[model samples]
Target: MNDKMNLYYLKQLLNKKHVMLVYAIVKMSVYICFVLFVFFSLFSIDFRDMQLSQSLIFATEEINNSSSLLPGVSLGYKIYDTCSSTTMGVRVAMALINGNENSALNEQCTKPAQVLAIIGETQSSVSMTIAKTLAEMVKHFGWTWVGALRRDDDYGNSGMAAFTEAAEQLGICLEYSMSYFRTYSQEKVLRIIQQIKSSTSRVIVAFVTHLDFEILLDVFYEHNITGYQWVGTESWISDSTVARLDKHKILQGAIGLAIPNTTVTGLKEFILDINPLKSTGSTIFTEFWEALFKCKYTVQNDSEDTTVCTGKEKLSETDNEYTDMTLMPFFCNVYKGVYAVAHTLHDLLGCNFGTDVSVNSFRCYGEEVYFDKNGDPVAKYEIINLQTVEDHHEFVMVGIYDSSFPAHNRLSVKMASVPVSVCSESCPPGTRKAVQKGKPICCFDCIPCAEGEISNMTDSIKCEQCYQDFWSNPHRNECVKKEIEFLSYDETMGILLTAVSITGTFITIIIAIIFFRYKNTPIVKANNSELSFLLLFSLALCFLCSLTFIGRPSEWSCVLRHTVFGITFVLCISCVLGKTIVVLMAFRATLPGSNVMKWFGPPQQRLSVLAFTFIQVFICVLWLTTSPPFPFKNLNYYKEKIILECQLGSAVGFWAVLGYIGLLALLCFVLAFLARKLPDKFNEAKFITFSMLIFCAVWITFIPAYVSSPGKFTVAVEIFAILASSFGLLSCIFLPKFYIIIMKPEKNTKKQLMSKVPVK
Candidate 1:
């Protein structure tokens, strides 16, 4: 044959070593046999599909076993692989046509078994020696490689141009584009089929009217051009006449953007009519068996299990798309959601479904959605249908859909099953639509929403943003509130801080009691008993104030946390300042002609302590009046949780309050340092000086930590400083005297106060 010589020359010219065509054959030259040339994946041995091959053989066996269909005919079939290529399929087809098993007229096209009909190369794209296109609708269904067919008129050309431009943007490539005119010859039509049979595209974008589409449909039917996905413009997509005219089922599952009012009357019956034993309209019955039964006839290449489908599985026991009519809504939306057009009935009773639908609306035209307590709409839908009532076509209510009901109970319709017409499946909840690159918005990849974001509805373009304290749950369906955090007494750190503060308070109280028990003693009297008692009281207040920072922050707690801290610390420091001044006065009174103790007595000491504490009180009040510390959530500190902490509003006011306490502490340190060496075993100045040193050190360290610490730690740091300073003052000033008074009773006498010697 000339075809064999051309391939030989082409191979010689290209210098190719790989086999372009390969097949197996049996000599059945006597009786007419069926040549079943099935398509198989050439590359990747693990992925080669043998289902179509099995189906052809199974059908042949089933037909031979059957007596009613072909009573006298004992049909024979020769199965072969076509390598899923048009050129190979053609060579194989030629070889089958020659009816030679070994060497034929074209040796390159050899391997022919005696056959009557050329069943297929399996896929319609390859069956025509091949076949087959959306830019959005095309890309939605992942038809990247496609062909374009159009009418010669302006309508077809303009529409196709738009589709082409969009397809190009969406990364869709057209292998062959052609037009169908009213004056085209039969030969021209055959050539177009020849082109389609040769092209590798499995999808076709037909931009022609319903009327014009008939011209090409006839040719398509003659060539058995079904299987390739068809996408049409609105001008033809909704035409029921064209859908009915498709006898070869060429446009069975066609989907595109348009309001399709067309419904196939015998669709259920037509779908159920496809049975391998009854109908020979299709050759790939094995694939259909696997799809309908949800089982594979053969184990996969990667799998070693011998388990395979029985092939005797009954369709009566299966509930698949073919049998289940209650599965979904037939008309699926790819671009936009189905907007509820609440068309009213004659009497305005209630909402209508389709044709004579009755709907009730506040304004009859307002498209407002009502929301529930959770801020989500509880949608109620009415199914509508067109009906002829009193010789007038009207919209009739058919069924209803209440979103508030449970999943299986939401819809109540009279119809047996719903038809789902879609370019691509819907993106379910928890996922957001990611538009395919170079494609339209409708053709998108369903990517899961990021953590902390959620998508409640199907086909959501963007995820919803959570509130300030809320976050997305694991499923990403709803926003749940984040965990609240603070330095509460319940936690480990909070319990420790609280215990220390309480222990420090009790210790200060016991020290006060000890001082009171020994009030008549020389050591207690010499250390200015009145100021000592007040100092102990202030230390106790300091310890207790820290407990305020241990619990949840609120308006009251926030105000108290800072103000109480400022006032109590200032009071404690002032008492030390008073004692320091008293020591200097006592030493000066021992000088010649000096009556300094008279002017600065216990009464004056009390006034100075009151005056020092009063300054802190005034600062705290001003801070509160202008800008008070209040409860605030620190979100940036941790992304997973909210930090329930107090905001020290107006840094100037907080610093001023703290600075005043530091000024008092610093003054006490200087004066105490001056009198530290001034006489006596019971010299209180030395003890006062050490206490001031600890107080100043603790407070000075607190400034940086307070500013640097995050969330609950900042509050913890402040409490630590308060407790540390209080303990410092209590131990340094009171512990020594208590040792003398209780442990060394001999030193608790007047001799100690007048000795003018160190304790050693």
Candidate 2:
């Protein structure tokens, strides 16, 4: 009965409003503490260097202090050290994923753990083992012609194998793949360095941890190996230990992928305020202090050789090596990871600040950290150039690789800042690339294009031929229109030859007039006056025919020039032949048995001249009707010029015409030689012999000169031959006759002519 009454009184007390309000406030306070204790775990390297640890801690603090991220819900974090080991990193990652470091394989988390997100494993090999999505990020960077340098271990071997397969699918050529180790012997390290130095690849993609890279770099420094464009993994790119090395000069102009860095307000001040005395519970702070100040804590002991820390050193004034906010890419990754968990939790709880919230809605420090469909943060990377500034090496953000940008513009690097990693320089215009045997495409020999071919761009594969009417310039870079060339009256050679030809023609005319005026004289009659007049007329025609070759070639000039020359010269030789025959007959007639003089009279001489001239005319007519010469623009002989000259349509016809003239001259010369000893006053046979000799000499030389001369000079040579031969005939044969007819009129009488000649 007593216990029943006590229970009734307790129920009455619980029904009071003030007692219920106090109970509800205490329940709300416990729930708030539970939310604030839920932590995001971060796995980073902190054994040899504490930059990554400091970065993760600073990032977590920044997100926890932000009120806009997760209102009324405070955030907490748990940090784990991987010691830059893949084994340790995997254990850490699995512990975070499984919610228990020692849980059985079958044991699953019945409730969500306080840890929400795991930041990183830092090293690429470790990241590959834990984060399988990192291969996509590497693919996004689009590196081709890359060299793969990895650690000689399971993490590196597996990661590089997967990376190489993915790279092959993306059409990336692996120039060389090599392995390294921190415990490598000096000989082995030398061999690796030699391989790197001899490799044609200039870009080396290193998939090694910071400690392994440092070891490899020591060997590289000993050998003075540099100028390699190192494409680093996240394992060492953001590590200040490598960046602050004394021999960092070897890494100048390196470019690599890095997580984007953002300023976390008040983070620098918080790090600078850390003190050993104030944070005695933090062993990391004490270690960092000793490293920064190069001093250690000493107790009051018997030994007096120890340096003691006063714990009064200012961290801000000292070199805050690991606390540098600017060089902290891993810090930003951890910072974003924490905020991502906070925002996701806020949406999960349906805590609306101003609008309806979704799991994807999240912003921290004014920057959104959204996860992709794969439940991974949207990958964003900064392309950084490791450059030297004020005698120290640091990474400068050169470009951004964002999926939001177009593919063509996505990977834009500052070309001036980026060094070229090619095997050879580019081939300039006017040349083509001649690829070397068993060598890369970039390693080729630049060769000039052959004559008449052109390459108008750099690294041209083949040269293109110019048009038939065009020719390549000296540089072989472009085709230029050929110059049209011919023997024109305006040019010097044409003008000179024309003047000479006209002068020869005028001289022949003047000689003809003198012979006509003294037609009744004995000297003119002694040398066959009709033949003399015909020969002089034919010589004038020969000289005038040379004028046809002086101007630009035309159809009429091409046909008439050679035909008229052949016929006129034949006529001249015929006249000499007729005169030689008459002289021989006259001498024979003066002998005891000589009817030759009567048989070969003026009529026979005329018939002889007409017959020879008619035969040449027939040949000329047949040549014109069958295979006529025509004006031709020849482009093949000279590259920069067009030879505007006549083409001999039939070579046989051209040679036949010249051969016939030569036959007539030879016959005349032979006849003149047989009658040269005759006692005639003038000895016309001697003059005919000399004239035919000069004509034949000129024609024989003209053939070779015409054949060998180029362009306009060929026409000039032909014209020169005509004028020379014609002048030879006129001066040799007619000049002596004119002198006797004008100055020695007594010797020109018929009685003197008959007395000078002796009968055989």
Candidate 3:
């Protein structure tokens, strides 16, 4: 039967192994799958093709050809060629040409043809007409768009009425358009469009100042104004303006344009090349003029009366283009247009998707380009959007003063504006405002701090520091005396009390020993042992209370030092109460049966000492957690260095602890009174009562001393109080008992001492 049972167990164990193996295999498979899923998820991102298109046409005429070429298409699917001048009619032509080219680039040059999006354009009413024309034509391509449409053609001398009529005729929405008749087509048109459509579109229409600004109707291939939409114009395309106007976003589709004293391929190098003393032509036009002059183009002086020959020297008489000039008089922006087209194309056509047509296949190289409300590319253009007609909202009005003179004529051209309030009060002395625009000044000049002042804060309104002979406080807001004056009696008394306590204790110990060695001395035997406990408690209080003198207000010393002192002081008082209880027990032990006498033994005495100490410790911990101290300062002042001080919270909390100690003191007194009737030989009640009275007197005197003392001298007064009370009791009581034990050898009997009656 045993064999059969063992066999059965063996069979069961073998089956269990297979089950365990199967379970392990299943868990491993699950873990492997989960890890694979996570790994794949992290490494793969849905990379859809991106397309960027910017159309800007302004002052230059080159934008006309850009309307048919690919911009970012060669790189991916971006269309960049847009007019950049501020001329109204010309901006229109640039916008149309850029929009058309962008669409073609997206549909033709880009592999896996994608519909073009984003057209840059000017905001002139005429430019809007072209935008409407181009929009209608490209709507079928299913692409997003952006542009700068004019609010009104005020510069066309066409009153607001005329500008609005023309805009309506072109089907341009004014709210989404940037307005202003005068603008740099390349600089403003594209940016305005980007700003307007930035919320939704990443495509743009550039330029609103072209003679053929309304040629946007030709995108239909039939020159028919069917569904085509025109974003804006190039300066060479817009008609002459007739009225007054201000900041506007006319170059909506412009992508990037020429910046004075800057270059496209090597911007950092170009910026470094600009010299303040040279003219604008010296920096950017260097290569263009060199090429032109090499081709024998003559250079003309400013007056046009004089000319320079193709050679490096000046010509006596000729009307030739100043090809040698480093900067193009009005062609620097146009020159950059060629490179812009090349860059945009490169970004769009770099990759070749399968030969399939779909919106998802549209690929743009970098991050999505910026656009205006109408979905035009945010190409380079001048300011086309203005918050107000009269406010100095133009770039020049808000830009900082770059006084790097003649080499850069565009002074007061703002590079950046203060993002937040610049000043809350008058500029600190030494710093002056160069120009003010709203609350923040456009320009500021830093001035050095005066002889006695200091500039501690960033962008300080004025230098501030203490006057001569005055020392700055932690806050640095004001100055105070270098040396503190100890003025009050309270301040002077604590030190005095500590000294007295130390001196008196030493003397008492000596005298007590001298008297106790002589047994014939009746005085030594008469006093009670309870006197010894009184001296011990008093000395403890004196020692602990003296610590307050060393405390100072600071991060390290401020609050903690004061709290420790308080706890120690309370524990000392509790010790005094325990002393009184011992005295009462001695008297009560005279009864035939009294456990109270046994309770007065050394163990109980130690426990009592521990209990008092624990209670004070507990209170200090509570206060530390509940209402911890903090630094104090004034709100109006900004200070670098801070002052620290421990200011106790809620005197009520402190008083509550004091009250408990007071109750203990009162109990001590009552017990002493009850035991006073006992014989003087063993009676300590009289001494206890006297010591309690002395303690009360010292504490009462402390209040007046504390109130009258200077802040720095308050600790001294406290120390004095501790000494007077504790030391006085030592002299009055414990000194007598020591005299019996140490001085009177014949009277010193251990059996007799132990037999003494304990107070109840």
Candidate 4:
């Protein structure tokens, strides 16, 4: 968009009269004084800069509006488009100065256009067309951000001021700027030292004299400050004394300007060609011969301490600082200084710039010749570093900061992490960064994640909340699954319950074996051994069913635990009811005209037990098919863990199963109570009543415990109730018969079994 706009504006300017009428055979004279603005383009090829003809017009208008500035010398402008070409710019410059557009090179010229000053060609190449030619300015050490320092004296102050103006125009930011003279107090010097240490910039640009520069090197050396890339001016940058004083190697990597040295072509032959014999009248030439051979003239040579002088000594064989041209650029500076005076004198007399020129008038150093804004002898400088060469402090030329071009190989710097040394370090993992008041966003405090929260990444902005049924680890770096709680068989309570359950089943099996062995004995037969065996079998199943609840709650275990318990308990109760009915029928048979014994015989007794138990079996099947128990994770009960347990799918189904078992137990308890005082040797109905009472009591207490127990304990309580009730029935109904068979052999007779004892 900007390119298009600029192109359109330039096209408009091309159609204007003042620009189109710039050239012709006709002498179109203008009386007004003009400042020619030779510009590159509406848009520049280098994106960093844009040169506009409109700005020149604005500046001329502003200057003309201020009468106090020019004092009625109205400044108008003849703007020329150089098209970024040095060729066209040269033609325009010659025409403006010679006072006519067509006759630019006519030496016998007339002042016609009255053009006073030229404002542009904005491009460097075009600007130099007016001043003959030019090269690139010094290719500085690639630093765009820096800290500035200078001496407080006039020379250092003026040098730094020029750098400051250029730095602002070039868009470089100064982290800090300070100045101190050699006469400053220790406290003031310390403050400058503190500022240097505090600012994060690694590069420092110091424009100071050798005298003031020594102060900084000493202070920084004493404080042991190193790793700084120093940018120094020529005054102290080349000083050998300062480099030697940097003993701790504080400024070893420093880069700065220094006077250039050169071995000019044909210089050796030029020296060898000179002869003192030809210049015999000159005493200085004879003195140079004495110095070259380390000797004195004939009168002084007679002294034994000195060698004789030979004016005919071969100068080609000699090698020294002078002959080698080690300080050639310094002498070249002197040469340029001479031409500066000559140029000044020529300009004052209106002499053309082409005459009376020396190698000094343009750049004539190194291997090339060039012109720059800072004429030189050119701005010829070497980029030197303070380094340990050959185990001694040496000033070595690393590159050039001079007007000599071809700088692509010379201009290089490591563009490493610029802001690595921030105000504070990065926040570590498991912690969040918190910015403090009046501090930059890069600077912060690291705060650890709070309880139940975590930060998994380094330098996290905030901590995250853990999900439900999860928790944060010790380092607070991540969320993990919470520990699951359940009554696994490995735990103490589960182990104990399992042991009791297996033991009860074992004891019941032993009783059934003894009853089978004593099937012919009266005590066993009179008490209905078949019914006793069936009751013991049901009680063993009751004990085994509790084992289902003592493990990790799963879908199968959950359904098996409750269903098996309900059916086995019901079967046990049905056996007790059947025994209680037989006792009542036996008591009624002894009464007049009673046939109750015939109706409830052995086969009938078995059928009654099945009929009653079948009711419970049906209830269990309905409960399981409709709404069964399944495993669930209860997160609401605890904030830190999950309670992995069985959840009754339908509350109504669970309660109905328990209620039916309770009804059967109550029926047995009622029938046995009435027949407890029968006149028989062994009234089993009284024991049946006691066992039913114990079963009812256990389950009565169990309901509340099952509801109130939490987590794994809830499963434990159910197992406990099952074990307690099973043990009650086993001890109450079978232990006495077991004692008679094993310990009392006489009670096993039919005579003792048939003997009746009246109840009170």
TM-score of 2: 0.68
Candidate lDDT scores, in order, read: 0.64, 0.69, 0.40, 0.65
Which runs in model 3 stand beyond 4 Å of their true positions? 1-538, 555-564, 592-595, 628-645, 704-708, 738-760
Model 2 alpha-carbon drift over 4 Å, by segment:
1-178, 193-209, 213-239, 247-258, 263-322, 327-329, 334-428, 482-496, 581-611, 633-642, 697-717, 742-746
Candidate 4 backbone collisions, by pair: none
TM-scores, each model vs. reference: 0.50, 0.68, 0.32, 0.52
Ranking of all candidate structures by their lDDT, best first? 2, 4, 1, 3
- Lowest lDDT sum, 10 consecutive residues, model 4, at 24-33
Query: Positional deviation of 570 in candidate 1, in angstroms?
Result: 1.6
Q: What does candidate 3's lDDT look like per residue over 600-689, in tens digits?
A: 676676677678768767776776668654433221122322222345565555555555556666776677677676654435567777
Number of the top-ranking candidate, with lDDT as the measure: 2
Estimate the overall C-alpha local distance difference test score of candidate 4: 0.65
Which numbered prediction scores highest in TM-score against the true structure? Answer: 2
Writing each residue's lDDT as its tens digit, candidate 4 over 1-760 gives: 6655544443344324122212110011111111121232232121001112222333344434554433333445554444323444566677776567555434434664444344433223111221111111121333445677876644445566666666555434566789877778999988888998888867777766455655677788777667877777665666655675676777676666666655433433443455568766755445455655777677653578887776667756776423443333433333333323323322423323334433233333334444444543345556667667766677777665433445454343332222222345567777899977875454578999886789988779999989986888888898888888888788888888889999999999988888888888887776566788888899999999988987788899999888888888888888888888888888888899888899999999999988887888898888888888999999888766899989999888889889999998898899988888887877888888898899899999999998998898888888888899999999988898889889998777878877889778
Task: For candidate 3, give the lDDT of residue 386.
Answer: 21
Local accuracy of candidate 1 as per-residue lDDT tens digits, 567-606: 9888888888888888888888889999889999878999
Which is the winner by lDDT between candidate 1 and candidate 4?
A: 4
Q: After superposition, how far is residue 740 of candidate 4 from its true place, in Å?
A: 1.2
Worst 10 residues of 2 by lDDT: 20-29
